[model samples]
Target: MRVLVVMGSKSDFHIAEKVTGILDEFGIDYDVEVASAHRNPKRVEELAKKDYEVFIAIAGLSATLPGVIASYTTKPVIGVPVSAKLRGLDALFSIAQMPPGVPVAAVGIDNGKNAALLAIEILALKDESLKKKLEEYRERMRS
Candidate 1:
């Protein structure tokens, strides 16, 4: 299984790295893309069609990338709100307050690591190896 990590801008790549770094720790396969819900909506639409188990969309400001991605696919989308102006709260609300149907699980401001963990947990639901890995990860956290 693979996860797709998309960001609204190239500048958000730094935050996205925190996600990929944790995925690497768990040996999860993933791909990253720089696409914006406003500036590059078409790219986001197309990428959503690609094969992937989960998506993590990172954005700041009027963060609409996560919502846009959620609109195109039924797969789980986790949002990481980058700490831009408004300290990312605007983004957090934009993502968390998505309308009734289009759901996007949002993490804390600039908390890409949690976004990654959430995605991994979703994938582990049907992946035995990943499930075992996550169990070990929890054990480590408890130690």
Candidate 2:
């Protein structure tokens, strides 16, 4: 798969659906998994080790999933902060304020679509067809 979409809990699946919808439209290969960094650190670590070009981690209320995953692998990680608490600011800060060395790209709160688009952009670096598709998508957006 080109992308791996991981949610911290089953409740976040709704947001994940937004991500998958965009990926589907772009015909990108992806797999979804529900694993929490707090509850299942080992599983999160394992998932990070998998072979994927990009990762989209959706979490809220101390969203540590993205940073944790970024620590495990050098691949790009896009963090989607769900609006679970504190208007999702807590999650947003947690994701955006990653310590220097380990970085996770943070999207807007509950913005899975942008996260998916960012992943596509990352993948497009090495994929000419995807680059063309992304250009077409942007043109459509401009209309």
Candidate 3:
């Protein structure tokens, strides 16, 4: 798969749907998996080791899933913070505050659509057809 969408729990599937919808519109290949950083670190590690070019990690509370994925892989990681509690500010901060070296791009809380768009943008860098599609998508948005 070109992209792997990992959620911390099944409860985050609603947010994951937002991400997958955009990916589907863009014709990007992706797989969705539920693995929590706290509850199942090994599963996260295994998922990270997969051959996907990009990862979109959806998590709330501590929001460590993205950072943990980043630690395991060199591929680009996009963090989508869910508003499970605290209006999602706490999740937002947790995602945004990754330490140096292991960098993860953070999107706005509950903004899975942007995360998918960003992932498509990254893939477009090496793909001419995807680049053209993105250009067309942006034009559609502008109109």
Candidate 4:
């Protein structure tokens, strides 16, 4: 399975790096891009239509990236609320409080690791090897 990671700004690269590391650990393929819902709405809409099983959108402040992405595609979109001004609460609510129909799964503030894990879980649905990897990972966690 392939995942698309979109960040609202270049400053969010650190968070994206953590996500990519987790994806790499799971041997999942992914593409990362820097696009903004507010600054580059066209790019966000365009990328959302690409061939990807899941999408992880990282943004702070208004945090419109995830919602915009969800609007354009039916694919699962995970929102990572980056910690910016107001301690990321604004971003968290912006992602979590989506209107009906368009849904973006929102993770905790600055928690890209969980976002990647969630995407892996979704992809593992049809992949036995990935499911085994997740089970092993979970067993390790319990150890």
**Against the true structure, candidate 3 has what lDDT?**
0.97
Weakest 10 consecutive residues of candidate 3 by summed lDDT: 84-93
lDDT of candidate 1?
A: 0.93
- Candidates 1 and 2 compared: the better one by lDDT is 2
**Per-candidate total of colliding backbone pairs:** 0, 0, 0, 0
Mind giving the per-residue lDDT tens digits that candidate 2 earns over 13-41?
A: 99999999999999999999999999999
Better of 1 and 3 by lDDT: 3
Provide the lowest-lDDT 10-residue window in model 1: 80-89
lDDT of 3 by residue, 1-100 (tens): 9999999999999999999999999999999999999999999999999999999999999999999999999999999999989999999999999999
lDDT minimum window of 10 residues, candidate 2: 118-127
TM-score of each: 0.97, 0.99, 0.99, 0.98
Q: Give each model's whole-structure lDDT.
A: 0.93, 0.98, 0.97, 0.97
Model 3 residue 88 lDDT?
95
Per-residue CA lDDT of candidate 1, range 31-122, in tens? 99999999888899999888898999999999999999999999999999988988888999998999999999999999999999999999
Q: Residues 1-143, candidate 4, lDDT per residue (tens digit)?
A: 39999999999999999899999999999999999999999999999999999999999999999999999999999999999989999999999999999999999999999999999999999999999999999999999
